[model samples]
Target chain A: MSTLIGVDWGTSSLRAARLDAAGEVLEERSLPRGILTVPAGGFPAVFDEACGDWMREPGALALLCGMAGSRQGWVEAPYAGCPAGFADVAAQLTWIEPGRIALVPGLTCHEHGVPDVMRGEETQVFGALELLGLQSALLVLPGTHSKWVRVIDGGIDRFATFMTGECYGLLRQHSILARMMPAGDGELDAAAFVQGVHHARRSGTLLHAAFSARTLALFERLAPAAVPSYLSGLVIGEELRVQDLRGTLSVAVIGAQALTCRYELALATLGVTVTRVGSQATWRGLRAIASTLQGTS
Target chain B: MSTLIGVDWGTSSLRAARLDAAGEVLEERSLPRGILTVPAGGFPAVFDEACGDWMREPGALALLCGMAGSRQGWVEAPYAGCPAGFADVAAQLTWIEPGRIALVPGLTCHEHGVPDVMRGEETQVFGALELLGLQSALLVLPGTHSKWVRVIDGGIDRFATFMTGECYGLLRQHSILARMMPAGDGELDAAAFVQGVHHARRSGTLLHAAFSARTLALFERLAPAAVPSYLSGLVIGEELRVQDLRGTLSVAVIGAQALTCRYELALATLGVTVTRVGSQATWRGLRAIASTLQGTS
Candidate 1:
């Protein structure tokens, strides 16, 4: 039986799973994976500490995804264009340390004349497809740069990136919206979110209407704590409206549980059907990519 | 001749002028203001210390403006509605210590079901009217909450407030825009600002589109520093676009020296004629209001 290592290295955390040839996770571990924490020469040590036990037996091929493959990661892998299949990503793979280590290439989407880039989430989307038995569907990976990717026949057809998480962080930490909002763990105002979505849809320009948040606060004295949630709804609603996703297939959201819930709620408000997928999809997808590469799937 | 006192208490600084029976500046002094610096009970002591030498005389009527009259300040004054001449604010005045101390009421405007409130800046606008010797025109007070006030025949007819300064602060301090932006004292980016204005005018729904700053950084690889300037242009441009300035006689921006210049440049891009008024306008306006009370100008 062949053994595989599936690695998901995000901005702040890293998770790796050890799986048998059948794609069943034999063991898994998570650790701090942010670039700030891992120095240039420290990745090897960190990786060894996390997955050393599994690799000791030999014949274990490791597949890594996310920021670990970015320019700042263990090895830089160029982005593969959308309409790119698993084989395209496989073809562009870079070997970090010869036959034992392989890194997945991130995906890029050129839509609306704007080039959208993804690193770790692409692997998860691939994993999601494998887990759900989806041949073609819309996959939504909600995060700092939330991505809406189109999957068609085991290939990434197209995708669009929204700065939803980044914007939320900006508004909360820097803008006056921060003053009005309270510090809590992902608490949101559903009613305000709904209203924001409606407003974003009706408003002609999304950016111009953002000042209305301050306007609402100054005029109506709306509670500050609700501003962040309202902003989230506005951005997401505007994305949905601008993208014209009226006839898209059921949306599959992949992220942490809390983020998935928020995306789910926002999409539900728009009367769209969505399914929640976990981060484990990336692991399965990595294994699947390996299986396909070895001609053993 | 009735003696009067004019006080301008802003977020971070407080200036009080003691006037003789002729509304002349008998003596003026300034101190650290802001809620953080002056504890609730410390307002009176700070005020007295700043203006005590001039307050030695008896029966002086005091008029206060700015954050001092905010909910968190010396006393909270209820908002007076637009077309809200001096009479409306005067009517809703809350005398902290009647006769000895009186707070000048901030102006409020309600148009198309939208309400905007202003405190210290209104005094400056009123002062600008006194100084400029004009009654009807667009008064642009450029600051954190940039107020575009319409003065018709010696009365504040209507106005709108834009969070230009606050947004600038947030973008510089907290957003990815901060990465490329210079420190707070950084110079202007003429090209980036112009592009920002053009982009803002063309983009629809600013709230959603505001994230374009970060998107521009990630996708277009625009320098992080240029982001704030771009955001500034976008916001100022949106303000200009939304405002109904088609028939206005002229635009007068009242603020500090540097900000006034930026406002001039922004307005110049739109090919609109504008004038820059100095910060002294607030003092002059306070004097004018005091002159009216004392039957002297």
Candidate 2:
């Protein structure tokens, strides 16, 4: 029986799962895989340390996703465009150090005159689709750069990225709002956020409305720390307004529990129904790509 | 001849003038005065140092304006309502250490359900009025918090404060826009700012539109340093749109030349005529207040 190794090499961490032919996990390990950690020549050493134990499982085909397939990764794989099926990504796979490793190609798409690119999450999107047998659906991946991706016929047709997470980080760390907010306070101010979203949808100029947070502080001495969360609600609310997700069917969210919950809350505030996919969705995506490649090869 | 000392204590700096009974300056000095520098008791020493030489002129009545009259200042002076004629502010003056020192009350206005307040620059507004011999006009005080104040019938009536300068500082120092923007490279991009303003006015969601800066960077790879300037343009542009300043009799900008120029550019983009008031405007304003008080007394 053949064995398989699935790796998700993201900006911050590398997670690997060793599985049997039937996709039953035999072992798993996580290691630091951020851009800073694996400078230029350090990738090989870190990758070896992360997966050295499973090396004895001879002929184990390693499938990698995320930034590991970028120009800066272990192998550079070109992006395949949407309506791109599993076969498209499998065709672009590049081997690193001969037969031991293969890197999954990311997906790219242009929609509504905007270009959307993804590195690792595309695999997860693909996996979610495969797992649910979804042919067409709207996928929302919430994180530092939250993406709203449209999938048609099992291919990523288009997506838009919002700097929601990065904006939160900056406001929490650098803005006056940081002083009033406490760490890990992720609770939703449903009323405030919903109000903000409604206002944003109506007006669409978040730059001006954002000052209201400070104005509330100056005028009423509202806590500055709560401003970030308030801002998150406002932006997310505005996104909901602009996207008009109220009538969309089958919205799938792929991210961590906490982040997904926030997205779910924001969408719920706008009366949108959504399904959540966990971290393992990414691994499953990589697995699906591996299986597709194995079938064709 | 009797003598008077007029002081302007703002967020960053303090300026004190030793003037004769006629309000002619015999000498003047300035020093830093923000809460950051004079935390509590430190105010007394800093104030004394800034005016020690002028204090040698005996029996001069010291009058102060700006944040020095705020709750945290040497003494808190309550706000007088608009049309805050000279008499209103003069009546609310607070004495500190008896007749030797007095703090000028700032102007406060409740108009159209919005409460507005002003500290140091109300003096300048009054000064510009006296200098121009105009009864009603718009006064733009440009700074970290740029104030667009309305003067009607020889009284300061209403105003709105835009955190323009503070926003510029925050974006330049903290946001991704900082990567593209350079310090003191504030060449106004009238087109971009106007576009931003229009976007803001239409959308009314400043936070949502702010990401446009990052989006522009990602899609166009536009100079990162130019982002701050673009943001500035957008904010000012929005202000012009919302305020709808057309065919006003006159526009007087009160602040440093550099800041005034930015406002001028924004106004020019909106096709509004503007004239800049000098640093002496604040002094003249203080003198006007003193004269009005003397006349009433």
Candidate 3:
């Protein structure tokens, strides 16, 4: 049986999967070392330590995605523009070691006269399309930099990135918003989340709305426990409102359950149907890219 | 010289000025140490280090405002509710030393179903009203947490705090928006700033509008030097938008020139007349509070 290595190398961690020719996961491993961890000329060494054992068999191809293909990444695959699909990405693959290992390029677009870019979400987006046979839809990949992608006719048309998760992290941990919130994990408050979503949808700029998180606590209107969840909804809601997805019939929210669920709740409040999908899109996407490269070879 | 100390003690720094009965500045002093530097029972020592030299006189009385009176400040001066004036705040001063050292109280308002509080801005707002001798005016005090106050007759009606400056600081320093911008203080690009204000006024949520700061750079529509100014305009614009200040005839923008000009430009874009007032509002406000206390004594 033919086997392949599918690796998702990001800013903070490395996640790798060993998949068969049929794209079935045989084994999976994760390491803390991402491209950022690599010192001077340390890519091969880090890759070996993380996934070289799985790559012991020659002819077994490896396909990588994420920041690994960024400018500061292992090898710059550049970026394929919007309306790009698997073939477009695979065509631009930078071969660290041809056939043995290749990295997929990300997607870039000038939407609304603004240059927007996404690295790994392109892979997951294409993956979601192939897995669900989606002809056209809006896909949201929630993360540190959450992306709202537009896919049409089996290709990415354009996408916008909202620094929702990253902003949330900074607000909850570093900004004045942190003053009212309790430390560590807490239960999700759906009511507060919904309220936050409603606030985002209804009126005012995020500049003023953000203060509600703190004021709500000061007034004893919102408990400290719910501040984080409220903030999550506040930011996520702002993202959803800004995307103005009210007209979009459906949106595919693909990511970890925790993050996607927040998007799902916020989107649902906007009257748009939401389809929750797991991180499988990454694997499916990497596999598709790898297969296309092999076919051309 | 009948001298008195007017202190604006905040979270990070202590600013003090000795004013005679005429409310004219005699001697001014500023120290890096604020409420944050005060250790357990160390307020007196820190106070001495900062302004104790002037306080050695027998008849010298100190009127302090700002974070020094917060729950975490020098002394907990309970907040006076809205429609609060000099009497309302001065009544709540938690005197460290009777008639000698008095800290002014902040103002709290449950305006829009959320609890909001202001410490130093309360003093500044009242000070601005008395200094400008204006009635029924919307007072805008720009700072880390900008306050939009309402003054009627001779009292503070109510106010809303927008974290415009604080939020701007976070986005410029910590968020993904920082990735594209050049480091350190760049000259304010008024043209770029006006563009940002227009964008904020034109469309989408602040969440989406903020991303434009980065995307504008990516498209080469904006240069790196202008990002900070654009960001400043963006948040200030949002603050103006959410304040629903369109109908207000004129706004009293009281703060440092740098922050107030951004607000002035933004408010002017909205067609609302803006009246720029200096940081003298803080000193004037404290002087008013001190005179009231003396009259009561």
Candidate 4:
């Protein structure tokens, strides 16, 4: 029988994991029922459609994370302030249903003058800390909005969000640069990407460096197929350059293989070590959150 | 009677000025017949519709500049190589109809590793120099693609193009940042904009700095209406930061008053002097080009 279910609900998609008393995944399912696609007051039904089949027994505690907790989400789960540990975050959990469905609160960093916020990445960040067993370290979670987190003594001290992936997406798909490239996604062109990184290392600004992706094509230095990868490298490299990476020996990259590898390549070029954490990190964190709820109940 | 017509036909709009034998504008007209909006093979008709009235007399020479001469434009006018002065550039003019209609060639920076092209700004740069009577100085034309032009000994020696304005438009209209701001073009908030420029002076990358526009809004430190101006500052600031501005006594900003003023504010903040040139720069450049053609013929 399923003792718990963990949900990672984001803007574009929803994923679920069914777990036993030990918090190991017994079965899993995913659907494209992201909050953006769901109509008003339709999330409960949509959630059931995505995971109803996996719920064999009656009362499996459901722990939800990500945008499902935002104001525009199903029910506003509110945000937990930063410098919070797993327990501090877990305690502030608000539920969609009084007992059946619990939504994990997102976090906000008040350390900086302007506060930065994240939804799903906080779980992955906490999980990364637990798996790596590090007291103070830098972590990077790359996506539409890439996050750079600082962890100290089992709590998230502070973090900054870089719209690297999102900016790259918008530029490639919508900007004038899109016209220069061929349709569909491109494979990683490591050399072209590294060339982009080298260009970013120069004193030129990003607004100026960004045009190099197109100029490189015009000059025949980079091919059309490699333009996306090169552009990706350009943005990612610039993102890394501005960070005070000095004295930071290594960075923990928590994300999938394809995306993280790009960051790994960029970091490697900068002479920093990297540790890759797979998507399972999110699930592991969810399972741990579920376990805590189980203990209290 | 009209002795000449200078047309600035770009991707989104077409503008023409009828000039007398003395290089004075006798009449002017503009239409939304930019190359991108016109149907394929419909340019001749569209051109006629825009300024056919000015072409009443058959001998009224038409000198077309900008995208109307691109490969996708009316006819492909190949680029003039850099270090090219008036004589070198004017020699490469390819005509639609000899002695009646001519398209000025654009410029390519073959000196730089990555070649950059500008279809319409060349005339503006030349005009700024002609109007100001400068033999050598730095020029910046802010637009979709902001160009930093260097004039030496009365010729465009070399220059760079930054996608500062275009990137800002794309991000504000199509990216996630759009959701954070109010609808329609926003009024400038000088304080918010200066705040963005100040952030650019920091070590954080543009990718990270860009998010501050949203974060500052989230924390209620900035008004939603001011976010656009703030973002504009962030981009223009980053664009200025990368360029080596030390010992450059003054920068000639050639564009509309509103746009040039923002650049002026940014440059002034960086402690550089700015010289503002108006829209007549393009028209003036076109007139000079006509005068040169008249002398040669």
Quote the positional error of residue B167 for candidate 4 in Å.
Answer: 1.6
| TM-score of the second chain in candidate 1 | 0.86
Q: Is the docking of candidate 1 incorrect, acceptable, medium or high quality?
A: acceptable
Residue pairs in clash, model 4: none
DockQ of 1: 0.23
Comparing 1 and 4 on lDDT, the stronger one:
4
Q: lDDT by residue for model 1 over B130-249, one digit each (tens)?
A: 678887778888777788888888788887666667766665676555665557535678777777777666554344345566557766556766766777777777666666667654
Judged by TM-score relative to the true structure, which candidate is superior, 2 or 3?
Answer: 3
Query: Model 4 over residues A122-155: C-alpha lDDT tens digits?
Result: 8888777777778788999998899999888888
Candidate number with greatest TM-score:
4
lDDT per residue for candidate 3 within A1-297, as digits (tens), equals 358899999989999999876676889899999787888678888889988888888678888899888767887877788778667887888889866888888888875565777878888988888888897889998888888888888888878777777778888888887978889748789999988887766545666678888777766788889888888888887887767565787899899898777877777776787888887888888887777755555
* lDDT tens per residue, model 3, B23-71: 7788888898878788868888888887788898878889898989887
lDDT of 2 by residue, B1-297 (tens): 446678989877888887765556778887766655687777778877887666666665677889888876777788777777766776777878565677888876553333556788788888788778888889988776667788889778777666556555665677655765557666665566555555545443344455566556655644655666677765666555557476674589888887777777667655677888887776676666566555233
TM-score of candidate 2 to 2 decimals: 0.78
Better of 2 and 4 by TM-score: 4
DockQ of each: 0.23, 0.22, 0.58, 0.67
Please give the range of 10 consecutive residues that has the lowest summed lDDT in model 4 chain A: A288-297
DockQ of 3: 0.58
- For all candidates, the clash counts are 22, 29, 0, 0
